[model samples]
Target chain A: MRPILLSGHTRALTQVKYSKDGDIIFSVSKDQIICAWYAANGERLGTYHGHQGALWTVDVDPTTTLLASGAADNTIRLWDVKTGKLLKTWDFGTAIKRVEFSPDGTQLLGVTERRQGHLSTIVVYDIVLDVEAEQADEHSLRIVCEDSKATVAGFSYGSKYIISGHEDGSVTQWDAKTGELLDSAQIQEDDMQITDLQWSSDRTYFITASKDKTAKLVAANDLRVLKTYVADTPLNSAAITPVKDYVILGGGQAAMDVTTTSARQGKFEARFYHKIFEEEIGRVRGHFGPLNYVAVDPQGKSYASGGEDGYVRLHHFDRGYFDFLYEVEREAEQANL
Target chain B: MSKVAGRTDWAEEEDEDSLALPPPQITKNKDGTETIVSYRIDENGKKVKTTRRIRKTVMKQVVNPRVAERKHWSKFGEEKGKPVGPQSDTTSIAENIVFRPSSNWKTNQSEEKNPIDKQKATLKDAKIKCRICSGEHWTSKCPFKDTMAPEGENAGAGAGTGAEEESAAPGLGPSNSSYVPPHLRGKSGVTGERMGGGKFGQERDDLATLRVTNVSEFAEEQDLRDMFTRFGHVTRVFLAKDRETGRAKGFAFVSYADRTDAARACEKMDGYGFHHLILRVEFAKKPTT
Candidate 1:
């Protein structure tokens, strides 16, 4: 179990996506560069320079060979994993806030950053199936409302629906096929922004992390409110286990002394995986910075995370305590992704 | 002696002079109390200012240790079922799994915790390198090469091996200096080194077509009609199924009955959105049967 150290891009890596087969990991940073690495060894593969601005999100098709990326540059670009070639670029005239590939790997979903007086909207597109074709008005679906601002954080089940976590702290479920509004609700009034969204393995429920330092579960079928788990610290990222029984949350202690606190040097007083039953399962408490992201593997056995302190740490539960495996300093700039 | 009345006048002048004298000084004593210290503001007139200092004692707040005791999931099983105890040394197994989306969590029973017993934690730590000769792995293809170099060797195995040697030493020195094959390396152990491969050792060819199923027998026709009309205007959908099973092949031979429809649908709906599903719309195969 040797942890591989990746050190090249110079800054924190904000976004990372695993290939369909989980063989490759693609990551991007605030440094405005994209890197592909062999998942197992953390070996640097190649870097793609497409977005002039920092990349916010990157998603690999769950079943296909296409890779979609959304960035601060206000354009979404399709890339071929084999050749690292850019296929097509679509301009939404606004910065892309989130990018995701549907469950079956057929469509690409992108959300826009906030605009003045107008709500954010999500764009759905059908990527040209043939690798050699070129046309802009191909298969496409666009869903936007005048007063609604939505950031589609992640997808659920087979991509039949999406849980859009808005900057306003609202979570809306949309029927992906019909572009109809399924159900919408807010955890609190413009107080908690859903930083991370994940679906249960069975597609039965989805969980969200709010700025209010709590993770709530939502029933997907009827959009019913489920249990809400509060963290001791402010929340930055959250993930649900593939088995659907647990969740992993990452963040740091809320600043107790606001006036004397340093924004850039926050500490992660606690990071842990909690059982959905409101039970604390395992925790890591040594990080002297805020946690940026937490990711569970496909099998739900072990999880990995990255923090503002430039460390990618792996944690595993031994009998009843979490044992730290390795912590690697990812020398890339990770900001919003 | 005769000027007794003049003496009274002189006495009045002396009283006015005494009014201009300074006040006395105040200071603290060794017993934590205050005292007056005498000082002079000028050589002739006695004037003073106090440098008195005061001290106050404060009591520290204390919390009941029992009330502060609370337990957490990360430290739950390791410590007693209280919050403010010594943090436990162990954690539940559910702590490490990656997260996914769920739909059944409304019920309190939806989430469960797996209890960790006396099982020893099997920490995963592996060097990403060759199993045979030690070398840097980013450029190696020899399945089994050493990650760390042995004493006295350059740790570099230069190119190419015979078929016999390659077969015998399935896990030998690294090969291929130019490209890194994506398919390799075992993740933590649940999935074998090739858990993602076909059930058997056979590799599926890149051009192999998938069989689609589940839609009505005319699913082929309906999809073709619906797509051509919406994709930008004309054509067809060919539903491909298995020959003997009569099941949808999980894929359809979609054709734009019109070439332009085919071209446009290819452009617009190639990756069309569906409920819980995203479809990869492509050109259908011609009916040869």
Candidate 2:
């Protein structure tokens, strides 16, 4: 599927995600605004504008009722999606880098760069209380890995484990309930920072994008490197389609202060790679700046991407794309016969 | 005993001597002894000290007076045709002051001396005289001729044939010349080619419009207008929608009140990656009809 333009942000976009049903898109930007739009149409449904600083990350729960956002203001705020009302706020005591909801929506996972240390701490809060409860730290667990700052983190499927991507190019797995370090392995060479980590729908493998100019699909059980997708630029974010064997990568030139002649040649578009052969299938070019995040929707019908240009684009896959895939598969089957 | 007494007398006389005295005298005695006497005044200038000495010894000169002579050399025969000395091979001052020719000049000179040089020289010397104007230069460079003429007897043909010949050779017509007046040129009819016939196509002189592409299929006319109106007073927005599906076809044409506003909008919105698409914005071409 090809991408379409949907511009509105006045500053750089930090993250974009789709609601549980894939009918709504949520995007946050450095302009201190969180906006919601209808996935089928480019209509601005509502904007949540209470943050005092630029938002760094955002995520939506499975029920699509609560939205969690982390910001550079050293706070994580929960909002009621339908009403655009701030439900709760927690002073994380550091600039939060990433936030995610546990699969069951019973817990919230947040990674914050430590205020006085070079490391980041992943905190899982027991958020099962009703909307009125104020004490969120009663049953929270803080897991800190020494000598490395976590760049991105996510909960494994069914909340069985928590995996955090670190600036030291390592991916560490932790026991979610006990806050114990289960296993850790270097996912990228040369100490390249891990920019993002996303799990496949089946949870058997998770994909990581790094500054080392490669994205790897790693087996979750043993942390073994399964497949690597190489590119010419540092990948800031990556996503795997839920049903198809496709991986989408987004990145551009390292620095933005390049000459206008060189800046125009930046690979700021989202590139699609075949998950099996690692061949680049297609590219969607629209952003004149670096792409910061790419998120495929729950059903894989559409995907949302945000970039340094302060734009959030929602691309929908056409029916012809799936038909083309089926034709290729059939031709391969015939050739084998 | 008398001689000793005489010497003592002389010593006593020398102590009372004055500064005024003759040159010193030396005498050779029979016993081969030489005696000399000299006088000098004291520091007070009132008394003179006389010094006298006698010894039995032969006189000797401190400096020798003999001259040494060189020995004669044997006669030898001379050899012929030998260089008198090493002759200088240094470059002259004039040659050193002159700058060396560049490599390009040397190459050109070498190339000119090849076998083709004779033919090239002959061709350059062969000049053409124009038949129409009887000028010494070629007909093409002749300014007196009203129309360009063909070579030699071909010019003898009437004006119609001459015109055909001129037309066959492109860019030789008077109409192509910048000096030719627009009204006097052949085929002077206005084809509206200059106004609208370039690569970007004809542009409307009044209404400034922009062709916007890569629009979201879900975008509405109002959304595009709202987005573009920030640059200027947007006069109209036309989102092309599919007839059967009733969805946006992913393109639109936006018009502004002023051309400058349209240009500003294009600069700001072109290549704007929005909603998963990169937008393309440029000046819209006017319809042919």
Candidate 3:
């Protein structure tokens, strides 16, 4: 699969997401601009421009109506996707690292770092009922680990559990409604930070990409490691196709500083692997810098990735990809014979 | 025959009368013997008489000595130590004059002035300097080579000087300076090591538009939309038609609301059979204008 490149941002990109309906693409960058593009042609539809600092992450609801963006300005702002208007904002009193909506679109999850204590907390607010709900401290379920900071989080496919990944290589599963910690596991060694987490379409398994140069796919119920995708460089983000048994991992040689491109290593491309065999299938090359995020569209036909180079790329699987899988299988069978 | 001879005699007499010379006369004798006499002026202006003889004896001798001389020479020329014995071919003469004397000359010549030595001498005279360290050596052999290594190797050194140089140089100053050492500090603005990716992503946008051809001539916009909506949301459909006739032009454009849908529709509906016509679908190129 060859990727289509989208260019607009001038600074490193932090997050890129496709709307649930797959009609719009939302990307946030360190340049402090949130751009919404038409998913079909990559035409700039509108820009959401209210953030005072660099935006860190963005997530779209299942209906593709509301877009939630978190920024270093210590606030999470929700915008209307169609009208490009700011709908609501929550002051978290700290820098927000990531913000995402529940699969049901009823709650919004934001991971923020307290400036004074240097502690990270996962705050889930009920968005469906109360617009001016008492601050997240009162109405939301706040989950904070004592020492480890949360890096990434996502809701389960059924909205029954919320999985939060920590900087200390630990992953914890919490009950969505009761805010109870159901299970936790150390999925990575060496205290490597988890960069991103992605759930498989069926919710049977989820993969966590870490700074340890590996991405591990684990069974959701027991959190047992299924397969490990290793790379020479740290993997920052990974995504699984909604229907197909394929996973795409994105990273590059680590950047020494956030601003300069002089100290980066490795090529910036999305590496694809067979979900079952864990064998590398193909790679899609783009992005001039390390990739930070990759999100597959809901239909499983295409995926989008953003990187430190500030460009977002959309890749579509061609008919030949399916045929290539069969050809690989035949080659494997011939080897067996 | 007598008349012809009389005519010849008259013509000869006429010529002799004009030149003041003698004319020939033929007379028949009683025994059937004929005698002819003619007179002409000689170089000393004397008249000479000529008589024709009926019977004469002729004798001729031819002498040629070249063949015999060749035989004599061939029989004696093979003697040893003689100049004519086994003459040297042209190649032997040329080899004696040119190659034989010089065969060992190269060995006696100066070995230090060979082609490679001359080339080295010219290079030494030119005094080439290294681009990196500006020394009298190649850049590859520059002493500061370790400083130009990748950032990971020099990370400790870079971190030490990073703070002091951070404010002085903007952009990639600290990062670039850390990799480049003091001896190689003349040229500035050295970007960094080149990262790898497909070069096509430099400026060209990914394939978002698909130009679909081979559409059924009878296919309408709604039919196209109905067939393609299964892949993704249909945004617009443009079917080519004759300007005046208002008839289908055998092709159409079906754009999707999402690029993934357009790609999916192109994959599935291309070569799709519709109303006995196989449809061809592909990404459309951007309009050049």
User: B91-120 in candidate 3: lDDT tens per residue?
Assistant: 011111111112122335456336788898
Where does model 1 sit among the CAPRI classes? incorrect
> Candidate 3 residues A39-82, lDDT tens each?
55454556787899999999987766677899999989887765
- lDDT score of residue A247 within candidate 2: 89
lDDT (C-alpha) at residue B133 in model 2: 38
Whichever of 1 and 2 has more lDDT, that candidate is 2
Shift in Å, residue A193, candidate 1: 1.2
By summed lDDT, the worst window of 10 consecutive residues in model 2 chain B runs over: B66-75
True contacts kept of each: 0.00, 0.00, 0.00
lDDT of 1 by residue, B38-142 (tens): 444566665554555555457563523321221111211112233432212211112233322222322332234222321222212334433322222332553
- Alpha-carbon error at A158 in model 2, in Å? 1.7
* Residues forming the 10-long window of minimal summed lDDT in candidate 1 chain B: B200-209
* TM-score of predicted chain B versus true chain B for each candidate: 0.21, 0.30, 0.28
Q: In terms of TM-score, which candidate is stronger, 1 or 2? A: 2
